[model samples]
Target chain A: MTPNLLVFRVLRNPKVTISLSLADWDLLLRQARCSNLLARIHSLLNEQGLIDRVPPKPREHLQWTHVIAERQIKAVHWEVTMIRKALAKVGPIILLKGAAYVMAKLPPAQGRLFSDIDIMVPKDNLNEVEAALMLHGWGTTHHDTYDQRYYRRWMHELPPMRHIKRSSVIDVHHAILPETAAIHPSPDKLRSSACSLDGYDDLKILAPADMVLHSAAHLFNESELDNGLRDLVDIDSLLRHFSNLPSFWVVLVERAKDLELTRALFYSLRYTTLILHTTIPPSTMVAIEIGRPNQLTLTIMDKLFTRALMPDHPSCSDWLTNTAKRVLYVRGNWLRMPPLLLARHLFHKAFISPKPE
Target chain B: MNISTLTLSELGHRLKKAGMFLQTGTFITHLKTSIPSVAEGIRLLYADYPLVEHLDFADFHVSLTYPRNLRRWLKPQIQFLFDGKPPFKPLPADQAFPMLEWGLNWCVSSHANHYLIIHAAVIEKGGYAAVLPAPPGSGKSTLCAALVNRGWRLLSDELALIHIGDGRIVPLPRPISLKNQSIDIIQSYEPDAVISRKISDTMKGTVAHMKPPANSIIRANETAHAGWVIFPKYQSSVPAQLKKLSRSRAFIRIADNAFNYSLLGIKGFETLTGLVDASQCYDFTYSSLENAIETFSALEPPASSK
Candidate 1:
């Protein structure tokens, strides 16, 4: 059993014996902390009636984290209400990712922690939506011209707007993937398939399969690995919970192919099953495996992702992990743009301000 | 066995390798560091803390280490890692001990939500605890150091961990951090106090920590109910005076000084209200530590304590 597997196994079956040494528990907690899934782990333990079995001291800490997550979820609901009121005049706004999971009361929302709210609107309505949000005290974060132009011209989302009063950030996206990316998911199709949330007339949640595909796209296409493992866990929970529905897997595969996200779905299923032991139907696996990377690429991806998916903690990491993350970071940029554009972006990013001061 | 049982060298060896699990009050922290000042800080300050056995679980696993790069030779710095993640950038190596103290406070304030933690100083006398909730540079730690030396048991110098359900103050009797001029003021007030060496030119401007009373460390597990909720302010050359503060005002002041009040939401509100209900509220201003200590000692004890 690899080190990363321990946290997943214990989370999967919370009734497993609590026999780890203090040092081992420290490592597990560190890994969970890095992934931002400590509260989720605790909630799972509580669900399985194993929270009490955890030693008294560590239990107190986990309980504290659980309380914080509860408050955060309440804050998310309040933010959603505020957004709903602001965007009431606009057409239906579809919630995406963590916000959608929470609004829809999915299993992944249980003790989930998130920092931003993502919503999708029609591309033609983007101007009206941005203006409405601005009037309602949400303004775009102050970015220089280059950043503003970059986001406006190429990205699927507007420069993220933050609330002046509440300070919660909202990402207003017209589609799932960036327009400049090789694959463009149809926003109109996604909006048409979105289901209206109960009691929230203006708010809609993505169809279940779209939610999973979007999560996968966001995780696999992004350069940042700080939340890589947590996002994968989100994918795992989404799959496990939705798999309970009849023909969910069948629809999920069909939807992936229709949406041009088969590549992302292929990686998501591979890693979720490999790392989390997520139960994917064998037939569904065979259907999706058509988009799997070639053997040489698969071997390289396995090396990079296996290390990258673990929380960047000392107890679960070694020398190769950082190297793997850096290699993947460059790869993410390469995948996002053509070679000439990618080179210019990298140079501009490197010599200019590396980070927002 | 507690950390005091280990020799300085043994403690250093353990810190360099796996870690030394030090149990304080309600949490166990597995701390690893090879820096000499950090080792010395643990030897001098945490000597009385209980050492958790190998099988027990720790609430936080932290490390203080030097950055591995050419920058280490240029300026030299230390970093605080919680579960191998750096929350803040590295500070100069000389600030390591103080950084450890700050890091421990960060761990509790940022993560410990089971309690309604306020940025306050708490000290106990008889059977009641006086919670001094104040913002930085308020001289709360100076008063706390003075009171504890004069027989008030130090509950905590930085955080008043109020139990959410019961509204009792959980004792986390760590060292009293005195910043800037308060470092010299504390030394002059308690000439015999066991204060660590002052680290000059910190972000807070020359900070030093006074050793908690040995009795407080020995009785770390003992918690006390809130009896007086005092907001202390220190002004130069002014005489010490304590005045009765309105309950509503006290509530607002505590909520303002709380680290996780908003994060805990309504539970934080109820806990603060319960605390104010159970204790007499006061606004205290003092320039003289002697006068301040005498006033706190003369306060009427809570009805339950009597």
Candidate 2:
């Protein structure tokens, strides 16, 4: 593996929160003189915008990201073709996340890095939409009883499902986030939030705020972070890209407030900025008012939040591990919950929620 | 050399002994192949059957195969194809159950195509197949197995390849898996249904495989149009219900069902949406498979466009 890729992989580990320890800092500073891989990797991340805290060398990571971008664009193109094929008959719908940005003329490979395909449809049409896929030959990945209940009952979308014949997995959703009923934005409104690609008038996409709002919603809702490093990076990239758009802040807060997700919006943006070192301005920071999450809301999120019930995060702290949770706090009615539900959810999550096993 | 004859529990032991699948998700050890794209072939051909016992009734099965010798690489992948647990924890002791291990091994590296085959249950009647795709307890295999015992042509008890380029559903007929309660339900439903020995305490409760309908096995090479795509939720006492679906909505729902929709892009959308447009869609909740069969048999296929 390329040195940068090796670093990328290691850094992507969910276990390595953005908390760069003293050793990590030491490792970075000393990487330049070590070996060709480290030097090359060091050179690349520098170019793509690595921190200067270590030492200065010609930037090279951008080239790496650029190379990955080239390959990723082609892959995204193929993914778009698959999505188009899947949706053309259903309706002129927008492809969300990775492919949508690429299709919108963002860097093909560099603009996005997506492992799974995510798409949204009108809520009313979930069944017909799912039926169409089944008839075509995709299989739903197994979910345990609690998760199944979570998706079918309180949640807005089903868990990620796979096809019987192919090797890829696709995640279908009618809403940007599940179970967080706070953002009950009308699907029609959300659909209207999309704009068609430059040439593809027939196809549509999520509006800028919709995309940003969705990203924040994800961070708050379940982005267990264990899924992969790319997921966190996706959220980061979108936040960076979306910032350039005028009036983005207005739309973000409006949607969040409407969804009762202001606090979530606050936490997501704050943590993303803190971790990714994304460039955000004082004006926008003041507008979203980072931190300042409602005490009640944050508590419920931290307490009720069992990583076991989460989708998956790139984070290695372990879903059941409380290391991260200790950093946050809660209050009132939820303060005292029994431990039994935790085991039950964890058990079901590991065993029951997935397909029969 | 063959492991198909052993019980699923035995196969579990063999898999554990084999140990450590290096590849993640499904294992694909690439080698020289004259075939243009074996992956595509498995996606379109390869009939399959998955025997994991963790789901509800009514799921489907399909498989993908390749030449063997890559067995080491193929071992860990067997569980993934059926949405089996990742090697995240100790694979349960009965993980040695032979039918699933051998069946999956046979399907993935069988000189057939490039898939790590999955064993599952599927149903079709009148020309259209309703791929009952789900992880075990979604009541897929049990339901598909039961339907086959009744009269629904078993397209596959395993993998059903749907060429992303063209959404034709390939019938990969194979043995159906009947797990836990459904094994008896099928026998009671169809007195003469043939079933294998039930091995209890396996990873997925008790498990068994039903022989594929003889005709389905013969027609395995044929492909069928997917007329319906439904996610069936079976509650012990929930009455059978069918709800009509829309083309736009079907697009998103089915997209979630796809294993490689993202990889195929426009083709995936076209294949999926085409199937939706051509088929009548439903969200079915059922308590009785017989009633489901009766209701399904009576519905009118979407009026073919003039």
Candidate 3:
């Protein structure tokens, strides 16, 4: 088994704590660091009362990582407060992804490291929202003309803006998926159904089912896999936490079908179960299996994802893993843009742009 | 058994395959490299350090090897990997030993947040640890090497890992790095000191490492109470002087020099505040190693002696 898988198994069943030697903890810590889930793993171990079993040195490392995550959460809250005051007149702002999970205090936000704050406004309000953020210290990041035009004309999000003083990035999205993608998710439906966060009339979070669907869409559609395993763990945590509510599974399946995200959901469920061993009712699994790809396509996807979901560490990787990631990168682009535009985009990116030194 | 017991060839052979695990005070590192200079550097500097057993776990599993690209044939470069992930870009092949030392520092400063780590040099006299926090090119290492040679126990040369709970400095007695003119200065001051071969044109200019004293390495695991927070500034032709610094100002400067102070948030703030509260703080300036060493020596109480 891969070291990452071994870590997950231990995290899943904390009671099975036979003495893990320092070498075993070393491997687990390396895998955790690579996957960006060190804090999450620590939290799980702490929750199961198994932290004492870990050796002192690794325990100190884990506690240190947890402290960092806690600091990041504090930063997120501070940024959100500034955002709220900045966009007070722009109407309700919908928090998405990591920021949303944290603001709403979901299970996935426990010890979760955040990169940037993601928030969505109505499509028509994008310009006003951007202007308001700019008026309050957020400025568009400098990008080449081609990237600027691509984001403006085809992408669902604006060019990422960073706080001039604090240097934290905030992504302003009007939709979950890019406009040029094959499937169209209705932004109006999402905006209308967003639930209001407690004590904040202007801030809203995605509904329970929509949050799961967005997480699935994000994992299956993104090109980068550096944190692919961590995202999958997020999905698993979200599923297990939300599944405690009655009818959460049924509503989740129906929402996937309604939002035309069955394929993403299918992949999410398949990998989360196969890799993380997240429990889903047998009926729910059978229901979602309707969107599963054909045998050959499923085989190729399994090959790609099984390798892709492992931590991006050399010890956890082999020759096929990199090749699979490259293949899936092209597939992501193909899924996002049409054949002709994708060709031009790839050409410009490969030849026209200056390579990073 | 300590690393000194292993033959040079045995050390090289083990490094090429399963790696040689060597223990510093706070962390044990599994280091692997085929470069002869790197192995020699470890032997020269870390001869007195303990060898971690085969069954034990190392805090960091690092490797330094030639990159597997056409650059390896054309210009020859070496990369430093921590647990098989490269943190920094490749450097010239000759810089392998320095790169290993720098990479180990990166590992501790970045990952070991259990302690409030400052980018400082630390030495202890009569149980009073002096923490010299300074920026690069500030002659911190020169002063540290001079002190360690003249009867001070070397706690650490680059990093000062302060335990958050007890407010004590953990000893991490690695090699003391001296750069440019300071290399000549240190060598002249202590003729018997074993200095490594100089590698020029590094980002820090010409750099060499001084083997830590045998006594310091023998007491590697000993922790010292935080006593003095001295910010040393080396000015050319300036007379040796030490100005008293207020606790609040010392707190801010030390926090600014810390590697992961803000990353640890409240615990970091509390630890730094506690350290500043416990120590007598100062801003020291000197051009001569001998004068600087004398000034630091006088700061200790005469009642307590080794």
Candidate with top DockQ is 3
lDDT for model 2: 0.52
TM-score of chain B of each: 0.96, 0.63, 0.96
TM-score of 1: 0.95
Q: How many backbone clashes does every candidate have? A: 0, 126, 0
lDDT of 1 at A26: 58
Q: For candidate 2, lDDT tens digit of each residue in A70-150?
A: 445786677667666666668876677766777776421243445677778877777777777767666677544556676
Q: Lowest-lDDT window of 10 residues in candidate 2 chain B?
A: B19-28
| lDDT of candidate 1 over B35-151, digit per residue (tens) | 988888888888777766564467877899998878898999999998777899999999999999999999989888889999999999887899999988888999999999999
Question: Residue by residue across A1-357, what tens digits does model 3's lDDT show?
Answer: 333455677656655435777767777788788899899988888887888877788888789789888899899999999999999999999999999988999988988988899999988998999999999999998478888898988898999999999999999999999999999778888878899999899999998889999989988998877789889988998998999888999998998988889999999999888888889999999999877999999999998999988887766778899999998898888888999999999899899976767
Between candidates 1 and 3, the TM-score winner:
3
Q: Supply the global lDDT for candidate 1.
A: 0.86
What lDDT would each prediction earn against the true structure? 0.86, 0.52, 0.88
Instruction: Give candidate 1's error at residue A55 in angstroms.
Output: 2.4
Q: Relative to the unseen true structure, what is the C-alpha lDDT of residue B259 in candidate 2, on a scale of 0 to 100?
A: 48
List model 2 lDDT by residue over B118-219, tens digit each: 233456777777765555587777778777766778776556456444666666564566678888888787777666667687656787666666667556
lDDT of 3: 0.88
The interface root-mean-square deviations, each candidate in sequence, come to 2.1, 18.6, 1.4
Worst 10 residues of 2 chain A by lDDT: A328-337
